[model samples]
Structures are given as C-alpha cells and as structure tokens.
Target: MVWTVMPDFEGYDEACSQFIWDLPASYNPAVDFLRKHENSDRVALEQAYPDGRREQYTFRELDELSDRLAVGLADLGVEAGDRVAVVVPQKPQNPITHLANWKLGAVSVPLTVLFGTDALRYRLDDAGVAVAVIDPTVRDDIDAVRDDCPALEHVIEIETNAPAGDVHAFEDVLTAPEHTDIEPYESTPDTDTAILYTSGSTGPPKGVRHSHALWLGRAAAAYNFFDQGLGPEATVWTPADWAWGAALGGTLFATWHHGGTIVGYPASGFEADEAFDLLAEFDVTRSFMPATALRLLMEVEDPTAAYDLAIETFAVGGESLTPEIVDWIAETFDSVTINEFYGQTELNLVVANNSNWFDTRPGSMGKPLPGYDLAILDPDAADRGVAERLPTGELGEIALRPHDRSVFFDEYWHMPEKTAAKEVEGWFVTGDLARQDDDGYVWFKSRKDDVIITSGYRVGPMEVESAILEHPDVVQAGVIGVPDDTRGEIIKAYVEAAEDAPAHETLREAIQSVVREHLAEYEYPREIEFADALPQTTSGKIRRKALQEWDAQGSVDEESP
Candidate 1:
C-alpha cells in the first residue's frame, strides 16, 4: 500500500524542499493496490447498482478472488506478458480483471464502451490482445470485430447464462475447482503493466505502454491534491468510466493503494441528482470529477439544499476548465477543496493545485508536484533537435525531464519511431502550450495545433473560451481559428446558449466585449455561431477539430463524439 512520509508534518514549501523519492527496486502494482492488503477485515470496495442493490468487498475477499482468477487465467493458456483487454462499465469485473492479469504478470488494455466499430477494432488489433473480459452491453460490438483480431482467441462475458460459440462465461471461469495455490509472478519497477491509448484529439490514437511504477509516479501529486494524507478514513469515488486513465490510476488504484475505501456505480448515464445521492449515501470524502460532470451538477439550483454531502476534496483533470467554473465549484460546496491538475496519457498527474499547500489560482495549473522537474520549452527547438527552456513569462510547450523513470511510460507500444519523437535532449515534450509566471504557477493555453495565428499575433483558444464562458447566457464555449484572407486566420467561437438567452447579434457583441476586457484585443472571437450543443471527447474535452470541420463543411461532424 501507499504511505505519505509526513512524520514532520510542516508546511507545503518545506515538505517539497526536503522531499525525495524512496522507491524500492522491485514492485508490483497488484501487490501495492490489492495483494498486500490480504486477510484484512477492512472493506476495500463498494459497488452501488441502479436497481437498489449494493455489494461491498473486504480486502481479504478481493485478494482471494484475485488469486482464484489468476489461477483460472493460467489454465486458459494466459501467461506472463500476454495482453488482456478489458471493456466494461464501473462493475466488479473491471477491477477483478486488472488484479488477476497483474497477478499473472500480464498487461491490461482498457477500452471504452462508447467506441464505435473502427475505434474498437484499431486498438484491439494494434495491441494484439489475446483475451478480453467484457460486460454484456458491448458483446455485439466485440463480436462484430472478432474475426478481424487474429490474436484474440478467448472472450469471457461477464454474466450471460446462454454461453455462445467461442465465448466463456465469467462465472464458470471463477467457480472452477482449482484452489488458490499459484504464487504471484515477481515484478520490478520496470515490469510492464498497462497500455492506455491517447484520446487522439489531433490524430489517430497510439498505444502508450507503461510500467508498474505508474502508481509510484502518481503518488505525490495525488496525495497532495487529495489534501495531503489518506487512510482507512478516506472514501474516494469518480463518475468517469473505468477505461479512462484518470479514474483507473487516480481513483481506483490510488484509493486502495492508500489504504482507503473506493466507491463505484454501474451507471450507464450520469444523472446529476443520482450522482449527488450516491455521494451523500456513501459519505464519499474525496473524488476525481471531470469539468463536464461539474457543469451538469450546476443544473441543481442548490446541491446541499437537496442532499447532504460529505465531500472533503475534489480533484479535476482529463480536460480543460474555465476559471469561472472552477470558482463556482468551490463556492457551491461548503468546506470542500477543488483542485485542478494537468496531464495526459503519456505523463499523468505531474502538475496540480493543492489548496492546503497554496491558495487556488483561478486560471493557473499550480507548480510542479514533488519529484518532478517541469519547464516551459521553446516549441521550435524540438524540430531543430534540442531542448531549450523559454523565458519565464514567454509562452512555450510544457515538457518534463527524465529525472525519474518510474513515473513515465516506457514507450509507445510497438511504435519505435513515434516513441523516439516523444523525447528531445532528455526532455519528454508535451505538445500543449503554456507559460510560467514569476510566482512559479503555470497557466495553460491551447494545443500547439489549436493555436490561432491572427495578423502577427498568436492566440490560445483556451484563454478565449474561458473569457467567453464568463457571460451568464453562455453555458459552453469552443474556440478555433478559421481561414481568413485579410488576417490569415481569424478567431471563431462555437457556443451553446441558455434556453432563455437570445442568439442574436446582441449576445455576440456582449461576449466579444467580455473577451476584449479579459484578454488582449486581438484574442476576441471575430465571429460567433450558436449551436444546440458542442461535440466533446468522452472525458468532457471540447473537440475543437470537430468544430473546425463543422465550420469548414458547414455541417455537424458525425465522425467523432
């Protein structure tokens, strides 16, 4: 399990200055989040279903289940280094599959249930997954693409009494007569654990292979963001699907790793009222929620007025958020800490805000978490084959030095050329743009490709959208650069207006005024179009590329959601 070295228990600055990573040579993710907690009577998990059914498992029960499943998988010809894919909701099978696979020293490939045929086929085939444990909801999608995946030999459906051709029932596998006798495979900090694909906001998705040390790398940042220390008293939860990296590492693994209780629900759709009910029922102390989920919660005129909430801390990441929304989240709950972090699939949870450490900066992603060396690098230097840091106030690409390999991914799976491109002069370059202030806070801009070139000035869509969202009538905003002969590229905004709000020139001019007042004159949107809704990624990030295509073709983009 995980433990914070807080024996001194002083302030944030002192802890960071004196902090150092103390990692063991050999480590296993399963041992840390599951196996090590064996035979304990403390409850480790809670699954609340929609039908008024509830299931709670103690640490001992989970460890024994993991043991039996490991043996069962071995009997199914699964061996060390095999790739096992998991596609399910927030159900018991999700964690069981991961724990069991790691016990056999296998790699897990998480796939979202919302993916279409092509999206599903590409990842499964690219990773060459041998076995898949999935919920019944996605059976047809997997069956439709099974023949295309040559390496995929077995499918274990979660709970289907009918047992179709070439598929094994999950219950049958777990109930087989083999006792829990197999020893967990020995693993080190360098042993492979998982392969999470990039969201591909700009291009096709690639598999990012990571080692078991991922949990170690995320420990400090998560601990600080969760308000410093967690123990059996902590109960954490999140609405994100199990397929996403933020939930898998930050919530599911981090909670158990810290000897805390984790709560989940098999929700097909996230109803804001239901979400609040679950939180109140479980007395969840901490959570990692996306900005989109928070926006939906805003629908409730008053949350505490409707339900009792025991939320202590909420960590937001996996998408961009407006400063207004972050502030609203804080004021909505009494005595709740809201922290925003910045990271992608390659390097997860490196930068974050710790309210106890320092006050929340409205628009800035806080200083680097302990154990990381972060910098703002010149975007053009990478193309010229060197890594150079930019001036403190100048905008540049955010990059991380390889000070410790435990926290970084090993490589992009099976793509050596692409992997090589990720590093330049010993720094793992993140293509997102940002700037550091004299106070050491980093403010996010836009993606490198999402930057707009207007006349001789460069602008980030994030800054513009944050300004536009300040208007009371605007519920959502997405900014992009469209082609213009006079200025080369003119800023455009796609907005979702409130029901009572007018979508005429009056509202457009008002939004433009807000942008002009908040940022430089050239950064305001030249044109605005109001839509019923904006297309977004599964994690709640606005798909600006989709907005660009929609503006180009003058129609909705059906290819991505």
Candidate 2:
C-alpha cells in the first residue's frame, strides 16, 4: 500500500518551499486505494451503529463487492462518464458506491439524504444522473422527483424489504455471481470523478466537479495536516455529511488514499455521546469535526474523562474556530492541537493549520498549503479584471491561482457562465472574505455575502461572533445585518446561551460589551436576540442566510438596544 507520489519534505517550511504537483496521466483512485490493497486482509472500513453494532470490511472484500457492483451497473447500461447519484447516510454503502462508480470510470454525485424532493430533483436534473444508488428511507422523495429526471433510468435500493418494480436491490448488485472477475475501467488522471453540490447559502446549490487527479490531490491534506503516511495504522472518522466536501475529501478520500482505515456511522441525527463512544471504541487516531459539533461536544460533562480518547490529531472546518473552544480542546485532550483548515466545496483545503509542520495560532486559519497560491483580492474590482491584491490586514475576497489544477476544481458541472464568473484573469475567486497578516497567516472574516455594512462601516460577522463566543454564557453566535432606516443597515447578533445560563438584559449587555471591546463601536451589534439554538446546515455551518431571511420578514424577537 505504498503511495505512488511521496512528498519531499521533513518539515513544514521544507515542504512548502519545494512543493511539486506531479501526477500521472492515467490515474484511478479506485485502483490506488482499493485494487492495490486487494490482496491484503486489512480492514479498510469499520461501520459503527448507534446501537453498538459494528461491521468491518477488509480491502479484499470491498474490492470484490465494488467490482461486482461495477459489473452490474455496466449490465444496466451505465458507462464511462455517466453520472451516478448516491443518496445515503454515512455507511459502507456510501463509499462502496463511490468505489464502484470510479471502477467504471463514471462520475459519482453524492446527495445528502436530508435533501427533500425539490433539492434532490434539482441536482438530479442538473447533473443528468443516469443511475441513482439510494436508501429506501428516501424512496418516497426520489419517487416524487423521478418523473422529472429524464436521465435517471435506474434506481438501486439499499437496505429495503421490498423495492419497486423498476428498482434494483443493492444487495443483488454486490452479490451478483456473473460479474466477479471484471476488470477495472481505465481513465486518465484528469477524468472527473465526483460532483458534490454546495449547501446553497447564497443561492441554489452548484455542482462542483472534481477530477481523479484532484481527488488524489486530497492526500496532501492528509500527509501534511493529519500526519498520515503509508502503512500507518491510522483510523479516521468525521461526523460531517458524506455529501459535503469536508468529509468526502478530508476524511473518506484522504484516509483511504493514505491506506488508512475509515470509520463510518449513521450521520442523520448525530448525538455527541454516541460519537464519543465510537471514537473511543475504534481508537480513532485522526478525527475531523465541524466547529458547531466541537462546541456541542464541549457542552457534554467532561467528555474526555467519560470516554477514553485516542485521538492524536483533531481538525475542524466549515466555520470559524473560537479561541475559547480551542482552549477547551487543548485542555481536554492530552497533547492534541485543534487544527483548523479553510476551504470551500469548490476548492478543498487551500489553507490549513498543520500541527505537524507549524504551531497553530488560535483564531487564525493558518497559511496557504503547498501547491496553492492564495491571495486576498478586491471583490468589487474582480469582475472588471482589475482585482487588486489587498495589503496585509485589509479584508477582501480570497482568490486562488487557476493554473494549479491539482488544488482547484474543474468547473461547476454544466454551468460555464457560473464558472466564468468565479475567475478573474488567472485567479479563481473563492467569494470568502479574509485577510492575511505579515506572518502569512490567513484570518477568515466571513463570506462576502455575510459581511455587514452599518453606518458607512464594514463589519465581518466572524470577528463579532468570535468575540461573542468568548462570553462565558454563550455557546454559539450568529451575526447579520438588519434593515435600519437611520443607519441603512444595523448589526444584529443572535446568541445561543450555554446550559443553565440566564438570558436577560444583564447577560445581553455583557455580550455586547465583549463585542464593543473587540471591535469598533459602529461594528458592535446594536440589536441582540437570544435563541435556544441557531439554525445550521447539514454540514454544521450556521445558516446566517436563514437569519437574514428572518430579519427581512421582521420575524426576529429583538432585545432592546
């Protein structure tokens, strides 16, 4: 299980100083992660259920199952370059479907099970998915949208008592006796492997297309950030939805690319206790969780004391990491640093706090990764092809060099206009607001759409949210701009209090004072509201757009300013 390409570095500086983006012309991730280990009996995946049930699949077994499924799919008219939609939970079947699609040189489209009929149908119609591997639990949702998806010809059901007349049983595809010795499909490294839809915070979800070479490039994040190497007995687990790029690329693809084992669980309704139990039982060495989940885990009484944790490297993404939670993790876990990574669904892992290479600075998203050239550019001037790079300490949109194919996405599926909008000359605008320091550390501010403008002053929600999180009574915080006739737009803060914390005027004033201390007076939240919990996406990112919508409708119950 040796890697074909080895990073030439002993430390962070050496790695970044001499980085190379060498990849083979013809590459298939299935052949690298699964076929290369087909003769070995080492467990590739361990599926743990909330009810304490566990299932282990060796590399050999998974390889054969994927081969059989690939053959069965071919028999059903699925060919190279076809889109195969996978709508399921985080389980063996999800990755199994991914492997099977790659084996056929087909593209895999991962759809979250949380998506309703409209969202599911929109993606299916958008991608022109030819076949779908779906869980029976979402059969009704799929059925409601199937008529609208003209390209969808086959439906494969997983874990069902009875499938519809036109539907194929998933178990039958894996166990089909006629296709046990099928050869894997051959594809070039640049062949598209997967299309992951975004969370649609600003608009409808866009299909992000990544090639096989791009998928293999995820190994850099593993080797540099997670300290994973060939033949390491590392077990990785993440509670993020498989549909999101964070879990799909960070945990599943990265772990397997390094020949490490992956741990999967039912990710629909994730419970902190169950997650901790699985991590302890499996002795997971590398773990990735969203910032929201980490905050929730901290709410549990002495989680590290209750569960025997073997986690050596813990990474978080999808949102800003507060200094308070970072301190809590440092104190709770022995010799573990809460590594932070910054990237979007379009570009995965551009900047990261690799504890193996450099020390982490709390509240910073660290430096740009090797093989990527990142900069903060003026968002207003980007479209005119005059995107000026901002100096250090000035907030602007994050953009990456487009020529770096190893780290950048190919396009937004079938939307060339949208893809063209993201690029300025040779730079791919990330649409995320951030600023860099003289030390080369990138400080994430907020999404360009999430920035607040109040009284001729620009405010980033992350800075204010980070300050609000420092309060002893606050657990989660979300900030947005509400319409104000006087100031044009006023800063509004939504705070989720800690357990047993009183939500009163005194506490609100204290929270406001924290923001006032950290930022300018105009940037401080003028309106404060208390909520039991903030709305979050499936990937655990706070839905600030939802809050903005609520404010637009005047549905928010605001405390006196």
Candidate 3:
C-alpha cells in the first residue's frame, strides 16, 4: 500500500492556488468516493491496529453494509432528513453508522464522548433527533433522558455488552439480510448531510449545518490541488472524527473521493508507535494530526529515519503549531512541506499553508486559501465599519468571505441568534483572533472569547502556554484568566509536569520564569499549580474553561469543570 513520489499535475504555487480556485462546484463529497469503488474489490477501508487485530472492508462490502443498514433504518420508519444523534467513542462502528445514515440521506448529529448528560440532552433536543446510535457506556444516560426527548423514538445500541430491554443492538442490522426490493435513495449535492456540534467553551455548543455540495466541494479542491498531484492513489491516516470540520471536510471525505485507502490504527484511540508503524507498513502517503500529537512524535528523535516512507504531506490544524515542532518534522520528515491549516467547526479550512508549493514560515498559518476572503477585524471597536480590515501586525478577529466558492456551512442548526452573531454581512467570524503580517501570512494568537484583559493590557493565554510548553519539565499546560482584587484578571496556569517531576513551588517559579522570558511581562503567568493532568476534550485541546471554573470554585471543585 506504500506509494512514492510519482507524476504530479501541479507544482506548489499552482496546487495551492488551484485548491482555492476549484472549490465552488466540485462533486458532493459523501457519495463520490463510495461511487468510485462500487464495482471494484479495492480495499476501501483498512480499519486496523498495531496489536494484530483489525476489520477490512472492501469497497463493495462497505457499499452493501451501507445499503443493508439503510434498509434496516427504513424498515424502522427512519426517513430522509431525520436527525440521528450518534454518541460513540473513536471506533470503526462510528464510520459505518455515519456512512449508513449518509446513504439513507439522514442528518447525523455527532456528539463527543466527553459530553455529560446535560450537554448530550441539549444537542439531542436542539437537533430534534428521533433516533440515537450509542455506545454501551452512555446507554443508561440516554435511558435517563429518553422520556424528555419527545422526538427521540429509538435507541440503537452499538455496544459490546447487552443494553436495557427496549433498545435494539447495532449488529442486528448488519447480520440481517439486505432488502432486495429496497429502492436506492438519491441524494443531491445540496442535500443536508450532517449537523456537527461545535465544542463551545463558554455557552451551548452550536450545531453547524453542511450540505453534500459543500462537503464535496472541499474534497474536489483537495483532489485537484495537493492530492491528485501527489499521487493517483494515496493512503491517509488521521484520528479525525466525523464531528470535526477538518476530519469531515479534509481527511475522510477527501481521501474517499480520491479513491484513497485510509490506513488507521485498529484500536479505539491512537498510540505514538502504532501510528508510526502503520505509516511504515502501509507506505501512508498523506497524514493529518494536531500540533500537540506532532510534538509527541518529535520527542522520538529521528522518527522519519526510524520509520521510513514517502510522506508527501504532513497536515496539521486544531491549534497554532510551534516553530520547533514544524522544524523537527521538516528535518525528520520533509522540509518546506508541513501544511498548517486554520479553521473552526463553523467553517472548513479557510486558510492553509500547503506542502506542495508554498514556503512555510514556522509558526504562521499561511495566507488565505483560494476563494476565501480573509480579514482581520477589530471586534472591540463597534464604530469601525465591517469593511475596515485592521492594518497588518495588529491583532483582530479572523473573518472569512467565500468568493467564487460554495464551500461553507449552511448555518448553525436552530441557533439563528448565535449564527448572526458570528457573521458580519457576508463574512463568517471565526471566534479565533489573529493578525496578518506584512508578508500576508496570518499568525494565530487566541480565541476571541478566551482573551484575558488585565488592568489596561490585553493578554492572550496562548502566548503564555506556548512559551510555558517550551520548558522541558512541562508535559501539558492550560492558562486562564482568574479574577483578582487589583487587576481585573491575572494569568493563572495549571500545569501537568513530566512523569518524573514533582509538583512543588520551586518548579512553579521556574515555569513562571520561562514564560516571562519568552513572552511579554503582562502575558506571564502570575500563579501556577502542578497537577497530574490538565483537562482536555476528546480531541486533546486543553480545555481552558474547565481550568477557569476550577480556579473560581477555590480549586476544590477540581472535578466540576
């Protein structure tokens, strides 16, 4: 399954420019890939792990499974446009159920495993989900709230253990024979594909709506630019879930559309060595992960030399990547090739620094992707018109207007007020704050909502944590604004030390010194605490709100956040 560098259609600049240019009318992403392998025996899915266990589904096998599942759903009166809430961990069952729903033209509402009962209930109710596909761990929670969810009529369990009496098992559909007379449902490009829930730190998570057209448009753009150019066939490995825009928009959708095989670990979650082993074994051509995971891989020292393969691109997103991490990947993997992209749940990748052609500037998230009109606007200044783009070097809210492109979200599901708040005229305001440099590359700082203001100085917690992470002693860290008597807010950091380091005052002072030297005086952490681990979502980003709440509740409600 390994692939080496072959005939490339476009160079770096051309591929980067064309990926943006060819986005408007590309095919629908969901069905395109499935269609390509309908009549073939190509390994459509290689869902495997390093521990000598796996599930391999050929293209035809996958298509048939989707068909039978669609029939099973139809037999239960599941109709097109019905919202099916899926609350499952990272497993193969997730994708199988998702594609089945897609085949039936059903709208999927994917909830993260980290969600508590309240969060899950809100999403289920908000999206008017009638049926749920759940893992065993959360079956009791759904049973607890089933009465309140009037729209929710069925609970299909995808569990290793037996569930409560009224619930049906997910295996029943697969084990049963397909309905031969079932008519194939035609899904158009504009069909409502999914409603992915956003993980909002402050308020209720908004469900971002996307159509088949928008989904396919992103895949087409990737194929025409970096993908097809790299190789006609590519093997992609990513831990990206269907819920995240980057995973749904970038990896799985794009890979499938290009007839590429997905070589993922067989286990529920990712391990550092298993990932490397999979790449080496499959000759994985393209891979994607966050900078956090990349940092872990960098610790291996000579990772590429150890597991050699032709990795055409290393795509990263979810947070701002550090210069050291990018440098290590280039030296270990390839130079001028770490493609860092910028995006949120609300929008797909509006900007990207592609590995094909453009020169990467370490920490900078490259210029706006073609077709997206990116602007940095000062959210603090109300009088300033929407057209007023902030001067280069000044921090502002990152806004995007898709020009000559049909590749953006339809709207936030049932949350019109929140949707209006994020959009200005025609542009979508990515809650993230960033600044454009003189060279036109954008530099990410912090979330617009997560900004900390102390006295008169505005401080970004990312600046503090980014510097704190540099100290060899720290394993994980989260920086948040804590209310103070003197300053309105002061920087307080909760750090998880390396496995061997102890949580002591001396270590805290040393951590503070690291931040003070690397960042501005105001951006340094004034208070620090050493903990076993910092709170993180299923996606692994440090959850600052959880930390802020811990600081508010006297740190005793350590579990509250």
Query: Which prediction has the highest TM-score against the true structure?
Result: 1
Order by TM-score, highest first = 1, 2, 3
Steric clash pairs (candidate 1) = none
Better of 1 and 2 by lDDT: 1
Clashes of each: 0, 0, 6
Q: For model 2, state the Cα shift of residue 448 in Å.
A: 1.8
Number of colliding residue pairs in model 1: 0
Every candidate's lDDT: 0.83, 0.81, 0.70
Worst 10 residues of 1 by lDDT: 1-10
Error of 3 at 56 (Å): 1.5
Q: Estimate each model's TM-score.
A: 0.95, 0.94, 0.89
**Top model by lDDT, which number?**
1
lDDT of 1 by residue, 139-197 (tens): 88899999999999889998787678889988777845358876777998788999999
Query: On a 0 to 1 TM-score scale, where does candidate 2 land against the true structure?
Result: 0.94
Model 3: CA > 4 A from native: 1-30, 37-39, 49-51, 159-164, 175-184, 220-232, 266-270, 301-310, 334-336, 381-385, 556-561
Candidate 2, after superposition: displacement of residue 428 in Å? Answer: 1.2
